[model samples]
Target: MTLLQSLIECLGPSNVLTDADAQPYLTDWRRYSTGCAVAVVRPASTDEVAAVVKLCAKYRAPIVPQGGNTGQVAGATPDRSGTAVVVNMQRMNRIRDIDVDNETMTVEAGCILAAVQQAAREAGKLFPLSLGAEGSCFIGGNLATNAGGTQVLRYGNARELALGLEVVTPQGEVWHGLRGLRKDNTGYDLRDLFIGSEGTLGIITAATLKLFPLPQTQHTAFIALPDFESATLVLNRVKKAFGAALTGFEVMSEQCLSLVVKTFPEQRMPINCQRPAPEWFALLELSDSEGGEHRRDGFELVLSDAMEASEIIDAAVAASESQGAAFWHLRESITLALAAEGKCIKHDISLPTSRLADFVRDVDAMLLARYTGLRMMVFGHLGDGNLHYNMLAPATLSKARFEQLEAQAQALVHDQVVARGGSISAEQGIGQRRVEDLRRYKDPVELALMVRIKQALDPLGIMNPGKLLA
Candidate 1:
């Protein structure tokens, strides 16, 4: 039998998609990276994945491991060469086990993030790694990307949440390391090796994720800070006052909020009216694992203190569940509104919390001087020091002309990020989108070591080729 025939026989024809049926897996969500693949194979279990990988190794065919395909960096999409077989792991969706005593859950790679969250909730737990794409993004993809969402401030990123991982090696060998131990001082951490490797090292088939007690009184509030600088001060004040209860702290500039109001009329401003809209807004949420109404009172007191200190000009507290959802809707709509605007140059960078305000101001100053009629939108997880700095072309500039400035804009912002001791790709891994940029900014020695590790793990260079290491 041919290579495709073997895959069909192993996985059954219903699971192995080809030609017209595989178009959805060929393109990325951003529609930025388009590629061709011989077939899109859906393996129902870890053994099947191993078999598929072994067959691809025999044929010398490359394998692009994909989950949900919701990654912004096009890490899951195939290349245009059509020499690759896309391995879709969604069919393996299953909660293998939930160790309530250990506070951990063993979940298959294909499980949706939102579904995992729901399962944990039903079991009286909270899987805190949350993002707007949680509904469709899979657990394996989250682990592959080491995704950081709203709760990174208190809990941590996807990397920290995972206690153990079961990966299928690039050589088609299964390495079962799913031990939910809190401390194992054993040799090198092989789990870390694959967590953020972007499938270049191995395919993560399952993971034992860490879970936390569900917050009893989760409170969300929207406050308009006085200026850009006030955001950091507000974050500091909340951290000092609320301590561990402070789960999230997000900041958004006036332009970012205005875009949402303009695009979606239903998402009117959350806070009551003032003389003029505050220059910036900060969204805060407090949560406690222990059940109590005092947690709610504490959050209210913090807002009062912030207002008294002149840090906030206006504020709105979510008194009910629907109100909290409405507040978050405004924050989530910013990205969708940006997409609606037009093509934009997006930079995800991290900096010291103290320097975030200045970075934004200085970057804007320099960008405005160089690129006339350029619009900027600033927002992101203020607590974690990551910013989604986006630049849009003014109407006078043509799309083709604006496209040419993408590289220059990336360099301009990244230069500032590095100077401030920050990272270019904060939460998002350096997939196809930032591979060249990673080369431009990453330390040579550090990158060389990573290359050595990749070579050691995938000697054939068939695992997700032409990604990460350049």
Candidate 2:
């Protein structure tokens, strides 16, 4: 059979799509990259996926494994060449097992992050890898990128939460390594290799994820802080007081909040704006196994102490569940609001808590000094040191002029990030977006080791080429 015929035969005609039908898988969420795929294959089971991949291997055709396609970076997007086959994972959605006693869940790769969270909740547990794209982004994509989100303060990254993974190797063999054990000192950790490899090494078929007890009382609050320094101070105070119960701590500039409220008027500002809007806003959440009254009391006490110390200028606590959701709705709207603005240059960076406030200040000052009249929007998970620093064109500049400064702005911001002993790409993996950045900044020895590993596993170089490593 012909390659196309072979794929169709292996996955059924309905599962194999081409031409205009395959257009959905061709582009990325941000429209940053668009590529042609000879066919977009949706396999229902691990066996079907392995078969399709084996067929591709026989034909020497490349495989680009895609999940949700919600990543900002074009990690999952294919190249302009149409010779590759796109393996869409949505059809593999399934929560195979939820072990309540062991506190783990084995799930198919295509399951949406939000669906996984809901499944955990239904089982009286919590899957806490909450991100903006949770509603659509797949767990496989999360594993591929090693996604980090708001709850990293308490729960940790996707790498930490995933106990084991089932991956389809480059040669189409299924490596079933989904072990839920907390301690297994085997040989080299192959699971960690694929966790953040951006699908360059292999395709993750499913994962065994760790779960935690659902919080009995989840209190949410939005606090207005004098500046990033004060925001950090408030975070330290809350962390010391609540310890593990402090589930989330987020920070946003006043300008960032303003843009969101302007774009989505329905998303009312969560923080009280009594003191000239303050310089920064911190959204705090405390999830305790204790009763609501205890959680609320503890949350209120921290706020009172912080406010008295002038760390928090003003604050507003969520009075109801709907109110808490509304607060998060505002936080999530920041990304949408940014998109509505003109062309923007974004950097997902991380820094030590001690240097984070200073890094933000220095980068803002540096960018403004160099690119006069440039608009910036800064926000992120302040608890875990990730910041979404973005730059936009001043209203006076046209889109073309704004984009023209992306390179210069990116260079300045990223350099400052590194200077402060921080990472240029924090939560967002080095997909196609910043592959060159990874090459430029990553250590020579380390990069060589990564390339060696890639060569060792995918000698044919068929697994999602042109990502992570240059």
Candidate 3:
């Protein structure tokens, strides 16, 4: 039987999609990368995934493991060759086990991140791996990318939260390493090897994720600041005052919030009445074991000190849960607003919190000077030093013209990032989009080690070809 027939036989015709049926799996979330695939197969179990991998290996066909297709870097998208099989894992959406006593959850790779969070909540625990795409992104993809989200400040990235993983090797062998033990000193940390490898080494079939105690109360606040420097000062203040209770510190420039307000009239900035809006706004979240009154008193005390020090100009604490959600909606809506504006140049960068203000001041000046009329919509999780430094094409430029300028803009931003000792791709993995940038910016020795690992794991180069290494 041909490869397509074999896939269909293994997964059934309904699960094995082809032609028009497979189109939805071809494109990345941002629609920045689209490719062709021979077929898209939805495997319902780890055994089914291993079988599909074996079939692909027998045919010398490449295998692209995909989750919910909500990746920012197009890491899950196949190549233009149309010779690869897209292994879609949505059908494997199952919570294999939840050990509440051990504070761990073993879930299939296709489990939606939001579902995982909800399951943990139902169990009276917390899974703090959250992102804007959590509603659609999968746990497998989150692990593959070592996703860092808002709460990464306190709990840590996906890699830190995962105690174990069940991965299917490129050779079609299942390595059942889902041990929920917090301390395991094995010969080689194979779990860490595959966590952020972007599927070049192996397919992550499932994971055993770490969990935390649910907070008694969560307080969200919207604070206005004069500049990024003041934002950092406020961040330091809260870090000291709240200690581990401070869960999130996200900062957005006035331009970003303005775009949100303009694009969605229903959403308004918390401190919009000022004659001139604050240059920066911060979304602060505190998850406390204490009660509402205690959390509120502590939150107000810090803000009051910040105001005394002139670190923050205006602040609005959410009076209720709905109001808190509305504040987050404003922050999350910036991306949607940018998408509506037009073509954009997006950089997922991270730097030392000390240099963030200087990096912004210098890069903003450089870009505006070279490319007149460029609009900057900057925002990110300040606590973790990750910024979504995005820019929109000038309204005067045509789509084609704007596309041509993308490379130059990226060079300017990435060059500055490297000079400041920061990373080009922060939370987002180096998918097809930044493969070249990875080559240019990554240390030569480190790059060589990565290549060697990939070669040892996938010698045939049939697993997610032309990505990460290339």
Best by TM-score: 3
Clashing pairs in 1: none
What are the runs in model 2 whose C-alpha is more than 4 Å off? 395-400
The prediction achieving the highest lDDT against the true structure is 3
What total of clashing residue pairs does each candidate reach?
A: 0, 0, 0
lDDT, model 2, position 379: 93
* Model 1: how far residue 383 lies from native, Å: 0.3
lDDT, model 2: 0.89
Q: What is the TM-score of each candidate against the true structure?
A: 0.97, 0.98, 0.98
lDDT of 2 by residue, 1-470 (tens): 88999998888899999998999899998888999887999999999989988998898888899999989889888898888999999999999999999999999999999999999999999999999999999999999999998999999999999999999998989999999999999898889989988899889999999999898888999988888899889988998888988999999988888999899887788655775668789898998887748768778988998999989888899999899999999999899899998677899999898899888787788888887777779899999999999877776777677667887788888888887788988888988889888888888999999999989998888998888874
Distance from true position, residue 342, model 3, in Å?
A: 1.1
**lDDT on C-alpha atoms for all candidate structures:** 0.89, 0.89, 0.92
lDDT of 1: 0.89
* Candidate 3 Cα errors over 4 Å, as ranges: none
Could you give me the TM-score of model 1 versus the true structure?
A: 0.97
Q: What is the Cα-based TM-score of model 3?
A: 0.98
Model 2 weakest 10-residue run by lDDT: 270-279
